[model samples]
Target chain A: MLLKIPLAWLQLARQKIRFIVALAGIAFVVILMFMQLGFQDALYESATQVHQKLKGDLFIISSQYKSLTSQQSFPRSRLYQVLGFEGVESVSPLYVQFSKFKNPQNGEKNPIYVLGIDPAFPAFDIPEVTQNLDVLKFPNRVLFDQASRPEFGPVVENFHHNEPVSVEIFPYNGTVGYQVNVGGLFTLGPSFGVDGNLIVNYATILRIFQDRTPEKIDIGLVTLQPGTDVKRMQAALTEILPNDVKVFTRRDYINFEKDYWSVRTPIGFVFSLMVFMGFVVGVVVVYQILYSNISNHLMEYATLKAMGFKNKYLLDVVFQQALLLAVLGYIPGLIISYGLYDVASNATQLPVIMSPNKLLAVLISATLMCFTSGFFSIGKLRSADPADIF
Target chain B: MNEKTIVHIKNLNHYFGGKSLRSQVLSDINLEIKAGEVIIMTGPSGSGKSTLLTLIGGLRSVQEGSLKVLGWELYGASDEKLVQVRRHIGFIFQSHNLLEFLTARQNVQMALELHNEPDRIAKVKAEEMLHAVKLGNRINYYPSDLSGGQKQRVAIARALVSQPKLVLADEPTAALDSKSGRDVVDLMQQLAKEQGCAILMVTHDNRILDVADRTIYMEDGRLFKEVVL
Candidate 1:
């Protein structure tokens, strides 16, 4: 029975134009579906990169903050109280602010999230952040993403000329202008949402927002010494922290960020709708192609039935053809998707990463899509009577 | 005839059209075909010979009587079991009914494949059957690539490949020229005699009736006469 599958596939290949067209249609749908999935993944990655890179046992934020990606503010002084709790090894205050940046040369403006942190944190606590610590610590300097350089308005031009650019920064509380120096560049993995970020040291941010009260900070990252139970420490912090503050495990923080983008944001809904549409279109195209093929060969099918070939055999042939079309189209579809992802990432300043798991998911979904289309036509095959051949 | 009946039809009647204007196609059809007998069924157009042949072949339901093929009753047999019976009996069509996708050799091999035979053996046997029908050189040719005579020969080869106990042919030579039609009828008669497989053919061609061991003439939905040629 399995040997016949290849034979059926060969027969499908013999019909060159129809097979190619059907395969291309399925591949087109699959590529569209993969892009949707990739976009969704990029959004999630963007929203959680900072939280994920911060290797803390627990995270302390304002209780009003539903997720790490949100703009809830806590008192900067709360970091001291968290450090005073039992089992607390160290607590770091982190500043997160969204600012509008203008390209000093092009004058093109874009929104960037400025993450301000101390350079003295343990390397293990913020592994990826430590890599850019030196560049970020330079006075009046900011580390912009290499991928986002174009949107940041000719930072390279300003750096080459050894000139400082007076850029205005709005810290929400007040707006201030500064002659900021461009430091080195850095890059991070593209998650589904949070992209286009700038990293700078605490002093530069403080100077830029000099008039803002230091009482309010965006969030706090807490690390426990070895042999400390992180869950217990989180519980203790939650009880001791003020009602306006919240504490979470590191894993919980990542989940919160993921849930925020996937559930709270429209990005997830839009992509999901697109994926569903792709699935429906794929099924419709494949089903029509197969149904038309069967109808064209109705006499042949009847003769086979008259020759005593069972209905099951007829179904096997239909399903084999569907699967063959799916696989044939999927190869090119995957290639096209990778190329599209690259082009879209460069054009939109979004990070789109394709992983083995994502590819596997796409392939499985494609196979299922083809199979379902084939299954939908089983009724027509079963109703095919051998007597019709007479 | 030693009274060893391969096909038994008793009081079989078939009708067409709705109840208000029903027309009988075959009424009180009592037939007993013995093994190795070449039975030629001859009739004019619309004489219901093809309908009778279909009934005997289990391709049509016996509405008012019993039809027994190889000792198994077919009148009320389950559809699945009837298919099992059909696998042991070969049917050849007027149009050759050869799958256009398959080559001449594959057309015959398909029948053997349906019977669950080993592929290598089925292929070899199909080649032998094609050779028997004098179509050995056209094994790789598709039906569309073959002439009318060659296509009919391939159909015969397919029907004979399974070594069925009975062979039913409907207008096996209808589309062929005179010489080709004679050749097909003669070959069918010869094979029937040599293989000892009972043959029932429904044909309108009267020129080849001389070769039939027995001939039955049908008209107006009933057996009109039996002629021993």
Candidate 2:
């Protein structure tokens, strides 16, 4: 029934300026960790936006396929082969290429990703694209991504107001521009490599790029009958498909694209390294604060020892202070990170969101970081002899 | 040793520094104190008076010879044994060493807290002890707000709150004026008599020497003379 005093809290509260400065230092590193983790996740999310939105159970890509941003094409005949499987329902050939999009208002051109599919079949699960498939059937008509960067002109705003927005599209290295009408709008946001997206008919891609052949395609989407085993079909397809193409389940397809950016690219490596550096910096900051605080109160601690209190009791006090700092410092850091997510997302047109998992992840990391510091700084208190201090 | 002897020491020795630079701080020290006895130890600086007090209070491990407090031998004692001995003894230093963040009542309660007394009982005992020291009105004041004499009184309340068997004080009034110094020792003597506990005070102040039942003087790490009042 003995009432234990919160010695850790009282010690920290006694020095208002020092406590505030310590919290500020911890918050700075927490903010650094949150932002690095945020952007790293956003990179994977944005890069796989199209892959996640595709309405298919299985997919086929060229064996040389590295990522969606890369232009890897295989023979269209490989896509037609998927239809012969027993669980197969239908297959659609998707042509993806980076093309120049000329802003009609300013006549400036920027690189845009173009996904060309047959208008007869649903190539994407997006409501805007599925609902407006008939519009793409018309020659020189394409659906522009509503989430595309503002640099793609005011296509969505003008189109929503019943005004026609026409922009010219050209092959990556072509000189002449092909006039295309912005038929509708969808929500595939930009990635690091491509700033805008366009959904067009398969024949339009061939017409726009004269060098493109009918037999070549970038990706092949395969839908299965209900209750069909996708894994079985994927295995059977991989067994029969020529070595020029690779088969993948939709889940693996998305992960494959994510792995390309997270493992094979320098941006992902840099973000991870930055997060580790933030952790090290946080440990150092907390260590310095706790070390100096213990040093200042060495006499009181020795007095406690002389009063028959065990070293365990004093250690408990120090660890309690560490936990307090972790939780208190994490709150402000999370709030600021939320604000920054909005700013970064709006500015870059990428998906930078705060998930519950990320929040929990950072909390655990902050607690661990502080505990590491607390463990290191207690050596002085442990060796403090009441005899010497008196 | 008599059953009433609270602290008994014989041929005790202590040293400082590592093996290469070892220096003896106390040698051939012999002392004894009975229950309810007030003993004063005075000597020139560096005469090892404080060192002997520290050894008797279990602040430092006994390096050689037999030292016993409340019937527990301390020579080559384990840390746990030293800690056990320490809990039964009260220590008062020259400085009050009050936790600045805590009030006077809480600081006094820290001693009783070591015995795991219930919060309500500890509070009652701490307040009663403070009242005995005539600081009832300032129980809620922090150490920083108290005067030097008042701080020393608070330290007295803290050391005696548990009614420990032996009280060890090292230069308890070194920073106080003559009047306050006399008042502090008088307060300690009154409280120790009331609790029937022995007091071993190490001091250089001669004004308060009359309060001790016997005075012991030391020079060159040896107990040279004993004067019974």
Report lDDT (CA) for all predictions. 0.78, 0.90
The segments of candidate 1 whose C-alpha lies over 4 angstroms from its true place after superposition are: A1-7, A66-70, A77-81, A122-139, A156-176, A189-195, A239-243, B1-3, B13-26, B43-51, B60-64, B219-221
TM-score of chain A of each: 0.88, 0.97
Best by lDDT: 2
TM-score (0 to 1) for chain B of model 1: 0.95
**Per-model i-RMS:** 2.7, 2.1
Question: How would you encode candidate 1's per-residue C-alpha lDDT over B17-112 as one tens digit per residue?
Answer: 889999998888888899988888887878888787766666666678988998888898877877778887888888887767678887788888
| lDDT of candidate 2 over B26-125, digit per residue (tens) | 8898999999999999999998888888788788889999999999999988988888888899889899888888889989998887898988888999
> What is the number of backbone collisions in each predicted candidate, taken in the order shown?
15, 0
